[model samples]
Target chain A: MSARPAAIATLLDLPKPYLLFLGDTREPGYAKTAFGLRDWAPELCIGEFALTEDTVSTGLKRLSPAAAYAQGARAVVIGVANYGGVILPSWLDSLVEALASGLDIISGMHSPLSSVPALREAADRHGRRLIDVRKPPASIPVATGARRTGRRLLTVGTDCALGKKYTALSLTREFAARGVDAEFRATGQTGILIAGRGIPMDAVVADFEAGAAELLSPDAAADHWDIIEGQGSLFHPAFAAVSLGLLHGSQPDIVVVCHQPGRTTMSGLPDYPVPSLEDTIDMTLRLGRRTNPSIRCAGISLNTAHLDEAERRQAFDIAERSLGLPAADPMRPGAALDALVDSCLRAN
Target chain B: MSARPAAIATLLDLPKPYLLFLGDTREPGYAKTAFGLRDWAPELCIGEFALTEDTVSTGLKRLSPAAAYAQGARAVVIGVANYGGVILPSWLDSLVEALASGLDIISGMHSPLSSVPALREAADRHGRRLIDVRKPPASIPVATGARRTGRRLLTVGTDCALGKKYTALSLTREFAARGVDAEFRATGQTGILIAGRGIPMDAVVADFEAGAAELLSPDAAADHWDIIEGQGSLFHPAFAAVSLGLLHGSQPDIVVVCHQPGRTTMSGLPDYPVPSLEDTIDMTLRLGRRTNPSIRCAGISLNTAHLDEAERRQAFDIAERSLGLPAADPMRPGAALDALVDSCLRAN
Candidate 1:
């Protein structure tokens, strides 16, 4: 009864590993999810707040001012922290303002600068701190393990809560089961994931400015583009927002999309889908145009668990012949993608 | 800035579905997950206020009374209308005490009970008007479509948000694609989801007593057991609690569970997955034992898109061999089940 996560303490312990939720429901869901998180890590109360204007500014300030105030807190307001991301300056601006107003903001952005231009401006304007999400794309981290012996290619998911982490974890397990050199690299928020090798530690969102810079990378190290996966559907706004942010941020070489089954589709409204191979290729091309006109989308991939081998092959064929891009399975993305990444990595 | 949900409403209007949760964080993730239920239906602003002995009773009263007074004295406090099973009395006692303290009490239960023995006792002890939440399970009323025609099986997941609904929807789609008859029935909270059925009567949970009765036997023509799908996970106390209540209140033929994937891993602690298949079959069998020690579980089902085919086949095979029962895929439980239900209906 006494050991509780109080509002005051939670707020004071701001700037912890947190999540920036966009939709109102997702924010509350985080609260609901706290029980499980707490069970996993009692010290973790990962703060939950809506990513609305006032929440970003005032509510967050009241909830968790900053790590600076973590000591003076009367009670723990939240269990932990996690900053959700869209890789946009406008969004990061609000988060930074929240942080500037005293709430440490952190996230996994491909290219922080590419997404949020003003974040850098904000960090400079008011002495606000930033966190590096991860190192540059070309040098994606290689988890020290039976490392990929060859052109090690890794991928990640789009968001924090989405099944991306699990996807990466599973992919790693699957890879290990097959005596293949591989590792997992987390990327983006709930609906996004990135699994790669050789990413530097600094890339893990050192601060908001760096995250902003990484998100808005103009050249978007496509060569270093860490192949990322998404947690929610391809249609989730966070997915779209952050996915596009990664596109503009790293301009990935080959985008591998992971889709889990069991999504709601009551209305035609956003039942965000796991990216179809075709859809992934299409988005790659589309995003390539939007992020950089000169960049051509290399290829796409899908989870392929829901489909049978025949259906899975058909999906890949559709991606290859129709979409004119290579496709791979999440469990085991074959040689096609490896060759492409090699070609891209080797090309001038 | 004004677009923030909380900023727009004075915690009273709570433009979002704000649920001021007041309970122990250890109350199993079920109680907490109700907050996430707000996500599946995004129109509401869901808020949570975790509690202990202090807040669950007195502290909770303070918020509701204050909120009611501020908002012109209209308050709707929701809790398990009747926890029923073996642990029913004390819960009713606590609920009654809270109800007596002055404020409209909403019996937010999704079951039909014969009678709340404890409520009747508490009502006698302290005269109070009880309010019941009448919101229909949103899935009902709308025309979902026709059931897929199929002979294959479906494996229900462990709980909510994990992927049961997705499995249901996708399995239905998968069945249709393969020319099979399939439908998803989400039985929990709203009672049942007869997806795509012409008799599209949405699941609307009425009074616990009423809900119990209907669920036990929808009509004079109903039976003691019918193929049922329970939403949320077995671990979720609220769901488990309610399901237990319903099991005793109105036991169904067989209960199929649905669950989603965990957002993250429990870092230090070890997670022993319930062998997916074995745990589910055992649980279902245990449920059967309640009615009759001799009554055995017919089968087990799983609902997850994350596992690859190899994993799925392994999972299915495990269920068949260990559980020593057939696989039950909610997606396409064929005519045998239908015949059993028909026979039950005829007998009733």
Candidate 2:
């Protein structure tokens, strides 16, 4: 839209010390963004802010829009998950007022903030900006299924919010530590912002999702590793289409299964229980191998954030013994990830 | 951009003796449209026209736009296959002249003719309407994984243009003959035009492809079956994303595998050879079972049109023995299809 964004932009360059809107639906997606930003671009992120009528601690200092703007916050970043449906938030009027008061707005919701006529008019009137970070770039062609060069690893998951982005970023860091050239290919908004560039796979035209992947890793050398962040899950009923498209499009030679030890049900579907880790591994292997028969699961990235120290250690042990591959919680320091990187490098 | 269309539109009322544009790219898609129009709406079609400089007999009365308009031709229906690239046809000027001369145009190319500025300007100046039949409708929501009430079946292919639409149509007719209420759910332009209503599944945004399918079959009695037409093959390099999205979105209770006998390469990607029928079946089962573990491949639809009578019979026999399923060419009269319909009906 604006001379086409660079493959990635420097988020830290944006006017920051920002306000993150996490409304009433504060799930792990919201948590991941808050934590990932602090880790990746702490200088830009000021603090967390919620729009709920009742007070809720996000484990960070909270601020109202007016208070945030008064304290050097020039932008508001919305990470709300409940943007679907026609229900507008009670705090929306005040948020629109904040847009009119000259604070730039950034949203990662599927529902574009530009769609709100009142907010659009307010932003225009105030000469402020509204950035829908989830919107994919225009005019990506249908995938040609061109043979991909270089080594690639994709992080898949047993469910949404199961540490796919964290695993990919971790792997990329490990590859970097090993002095191997690697880049984190983000597929969602938070990851995109963290990595400074990647396609919003869910926002793309269905036909071009794979093409976006192909374009992202165009003509890599045999030694380079493109560690791609996968979205959704094969078991995620609401979003498996996105997951499958990314999996096939990325055409990874090696895959890492990211899982949470304490989860029993799918992210949103309570009626649908999460499949066993072995089955998830099996499905990933089966689906990924459709395009690349050489695809193998190099390791497991366990998300033990919700588990205690004892439970977390048990998860790592169970995952390692059952899958017989390197397994570790990506959020914590572990040797399993380093082993995975070594194996993938050796295989390549 | 206008009011949402009904699930199906009655094309019988359109001005008759229509001109069908085959153009130079007469692959399987073109041939299917030509023969399908003859079978479904013969009275509406007057002639076929190709825009090749070389002499090519299309076995129909060749008429120029002015010449066709001199007769009873009131519209031009395009089914060309070479619409992906930026190259316009050599005869495009004359075709636009026809559009300016008041011939309403209908195109099924992935490239939207409306996007061509000159043609759009000409059509606007002349008050002639241009209809892109493959454009997906306005915003469709992400699938809610709603519990569907009626039975549904989807026909997947081993490659593009391998008789997915034909198999679904055949199954719909078989159900009709058995006094069962059923509808053929089209997901592409030709099938949409033939059935009088359906989504252009490939043209949809990636997130909403499955939503389109979910929206197509809202609710029906247990006895009513919705036979859905699938697009692209699971192994197709260029279009597998569409195939996977449709499969997940349709959430079919039963699946049908469509294949072409003696075809060695993918329809477009010659470098990518078609997998063995056994492998295709296994892949379909593996993917489809992700959504519905109860999902079963009910039958196989063989496109033996390229084979002689003896060869066709041999092809069907090989498919039946190898897959252990009833297999037949939908274009030919056979009990295999009837058996499939009966099995699905009984299963429902």
Candidate 3:
């Protein structure tokens, strides 16, 4: 990571006190960025903006670009990760208005803000910066497979957009609460925006994916824990490479398999069915052993948000009973989460 | 692959015939590009050039830039793939002289020829194109895991820089000789230079690795066989991601495991040992089944260049007996190679 000076300089340099932009998406999954910032870094978020009234909300105050600027927001962050990460033409006027209102625009999309001529012209005329967190570092060395010191807990999933990030973030917090040195390592756009610095795993060149992952979580104290947020899934045909690279490079001592009980099909891919929890844990442990021979599954983090309280309880009960591992939802903090964290910390 | 017009335009459009430039290196392994061209596309190669007189020879007639141009060579291709695919500073003068002598420069190096000021200036002055075949296609889709209609036989290996490409090329030739509809799909710089068209697997964005692989060998006739040249090894910590991605995307029904018997360590990675042939085949088949459920190993392609006639025979015998698969050196064509090809074609 140190080899990339340009990426390092901008890694944690995004303008704060932000206005979140939920770009006309009704699907709450796409607006995970907005909700993530609201939940993780509430102090930095001044307000939220959206194209339509029916769009998903972060439960924050709604403010126009001018109003957000007047309220002391320094930047307007696009808080939506739509399919293909494209900047739609319908959202261009609002982004331009944000620039004219004296706020810079920050994005996590694969398509750069500069690619849109209107946004680029507006930013240029207003002298506002356009930041893209999805851009990878300029230089990344190939992973040497050389082991690094420190304990790491990575959250892998049966499919993409599950609870990997949330699980990692919660575990890191719980570790710190128990007087352990812990760092949350981000590997995607939302996680990077929340953590302020991280390698965009998906954006890196295929050869450098593992190298970038290695740089993302470097060596630290023996007792320190690097809780890494995983990306994609081993069963995910489109992104298995990214997931495998992150898994090998992170070299996690403990892994938490994230799953949503009733996910019949993979996210965004209706053709492929979600793999079973047994297969997920088995594959994760088997592939993970390549880098960390002692790698073990700590537990399962169920995304039971769509289920009722009774269903959530049944899901946890079934998972723990079948896998012989702790099962919990990070969003519902209690003895379950504590047990999951305990199992992770007890591993080493 | 068709979505990337720029890459498609330059895919098989290199100026020919080529004058192979072996930059000062005496290692035959580093000069694979030269040897590959001389062996596979001898008609397209006019002669070989090198900075040092003692450098490894492709056995083609030696020629200077002017001499090569006079003999109807249209381009000077950098025929060496050194550590990191770097263009050495010492080789700049010879490349400049080639451009000055009215020959375009075709490079397969990771470092783009346009990156060097001197080479760029020389090419610009001489109006010669600096084509980098290692550059990936512009637009690649994510792999959908939906099976394409065709038969595929991929050449994987126990380690990098073995005989994956050579085995693949030989198999394609053998299949065609048998009156089968077959094609050689290249994935690396050397293979691309030899095949004249390919997606640079390592150069692709990590998220799109499988996508690029899918595009490279798109749906063909049901009986058509794509002999894909594999990249890194699954046991290779630095490159396992690329290997896995290619495996999943290619979705091959048959795989030929390539290995060098005496190699103790991974290519350029001294810390890691090369996995045994059994482990290599086992892991490859296990992971490859994710996309192609009927995936099976056809044989092992042994790189027995370092061994004498008796040693080579012993190595092949040991490999075949131990793994229960045909083992042969593609360089030493015989019944062994024919058996390997027969096994691959019979897999459908």
Candidate 4:
């Protein structure tokens, strides 16, 4: 056979580069890549260049639907910006034309390309792989205080600032203390375009019941069990919807509700921190049972710093009675938390 | 008071009418702008018709430069074809020029302006705010799953795959079950660049630990915890490293370690899902302790699909004897899981 068909020939006979990189200087991710270049793929041949009308046009010129096949670069991953907020057609056409030229194209957009019709069209095309980088939080190991795979935190929040970072940090530290590793996955943000992505609604509900089982189950790391929190509650409908949807899919080990008892005027919720203990527990319990009747809840991690000594105590006790867990706050000494968690494990 | 200085903007300021509405388009955000039609602060505005070929003739244009703001609009938000990658200068410059007349500009890039010197220089000279959306997963909320959010998954191994939509979907489901509304923050195909921004050497290891924490943590929605994976153990080190670093900054609660025991390999440890008994508890304790040492662990979720009945039972027995908790494979019957978890919780 005289080398078979070109596409077939290349498919059968080709030694592609183990590494090649293309990035744009238009975003933070561009430099972010530079930080860990040696780690992502040390051996791959990488190329970093500015993307301009000239550069993009030039990059496209450099590729050939057929030639790329010959030279052996089968994939092209295009990174786009998110804060910019919208995807423009003219901007995408330049890349899409080249994508048509035969390379396996992976388009990475930081936001949902709901506004960009060109993007949607190109994505609809065959042989084109469109990946929204904004679909999930990149998961990895980290430590709040100690070390070991301590805690796996699903970072959630009402708006961008409910001390999501703080809560995640506190929990990680707690888990680390017990010699467990923690992985943080940021789930929701205020700006739906930037932080939130729609996942199936049905799947989210299932994870709730799973959460209870996880808490009651034995942990492989330390002697006790665990906890998980979504970013929002029913109070914050959009994110709560997403959080709920996710539960349906994950079937989490157990579910825990974290929120300041007070309310906040912004984002259309009660004050960020509820002033009353009874309200907090009532809300937590009410929200906890939405997914599964079997789903058990780990007591709240009273964000005590936000409240005074009395309010904190009241909140702790209230949450304890409502959720059937021990009184615990992250910032305080761990003995109580340990005891509370231990008892819960034992009692279950 | 020179109009109190136009609250300069970028593409985000573009009027809804200029946008050629297509298949499914809605600026839920734009609809909610507090500023009236003169809604044009001029700082942020994105428009292709506004920026001509002349904008690209020069090097880079300042979309919302303090010195040169948009002509008519006082404020605007920059837009970029910043899908998963960065934007071209031709496009960026055009966006920059959209803002003129001395309005406070916000430099929006696919990554961070700091990623490249040119963008930084523009931001510095123009007194524009540089927002790094890539490093910090954007906090935008949008319902785009099903028809809203599309699916594209490529498993380049574990670390890379963790950034996939499926993982986010699982997280969303987990949260939903808890009735803690959560949304998917689609960072979309986070490459080594944004994903590995500040990772340390032990990133890969962190991811593995994270997996375990998710499984073991009693809290179904592991939003409180951060990372559960061990360092230096992920399929992609950058993902592990950056994930941990990001979480370190964000600070999560606890971590769960998902252990896979097999042949001795990468970390000089046996595979977690191995056939032997000690493989379960021994590997978990080591992994958990190494990742973090503060937070508590829930339990382990066994990947029993890889093991035969006897092997699974032996593994389960080992876990029970060693860790004193229930075991589960994400694939087990619900009753089996509930009964096991119930017993484990009651076993105090």
Interface RMSD of 1: 24.6
Whose lDDT is greatest here?
A: 3
Off by over 4 Å in 4: A1-84, A88-126, A133-229, A237-263, A266-278, A287-348, B1-348
Query: Can you write out model 1's per-residue Cα lDDT over B1-348, one digit (the tens) per residue?
Result: 221123210001111222333444344333432433332332222233333443332122234333433444332234222232122333444445544544333334443221566555554555544433232322111111111121112223444345444444434444445544344334333222112111101122211211332232232222112233343333221122223223322233443344322323111213313224445555544533332233333344454356665766675666557645554333445642342223222321
Candidate 3 lDDT (Cα, whole model)? 0.87
For model 3, how does the per-residue alpha-carbon lDDT over B55-127 read when each residue is reduced to its tens digit?
A: 8999999999999999999999998887766788889999999999999998987678888899999999999
lDDT of 4 by residue, A101-217 (tens): 544443334345434566557656845544443333222111111112222223333332344434444554566566655432323221111111222121121112122222212
RMSD of every candidate to native, in Å, equals: 23.5, 6.7, 4.5, 25.9
Could you tell which candidate, 3 or 4, scores higher by DockQ?
A: 3
Residue-by-residue lDDT tens digits, candidate 1, A11-60? 01123434333323334433432333333223333344444443322123
List-wise, what DockQ does each model earn? 0.01, 0.31, 0.47, 0.01
Off by over 4 Å in 1: A1-185, A188-239, A257-280, A333-348, B1-348
Q: Using alpha carbons, what is the TM-score of model 2?
A: 0.77
Interface RMSD to the true structure, each candidate: 24.6, 7.0, 5.6, 19.0
Q: Is the docking of candidate 4 incorrect, acceptable, medium or high quality?
A: incorrect
- The better-scoring model by lDDT among 3 and 4 is 3
Question: What is the lDDT of every predicted structure here?
Answer: 0.35, 0.74, 0.87, 0.34
Error of 1 at B24 (Å): 57
lDDT for model 2, please: 0.74
Arrange candidates by DockQ, highest first: which order? 3, 2, 4, 1
Evaluate candidate 2 and give its CAPRI docking class based on DockQ. acceptable
Highest DockQ among the candidates is held by which one? 3
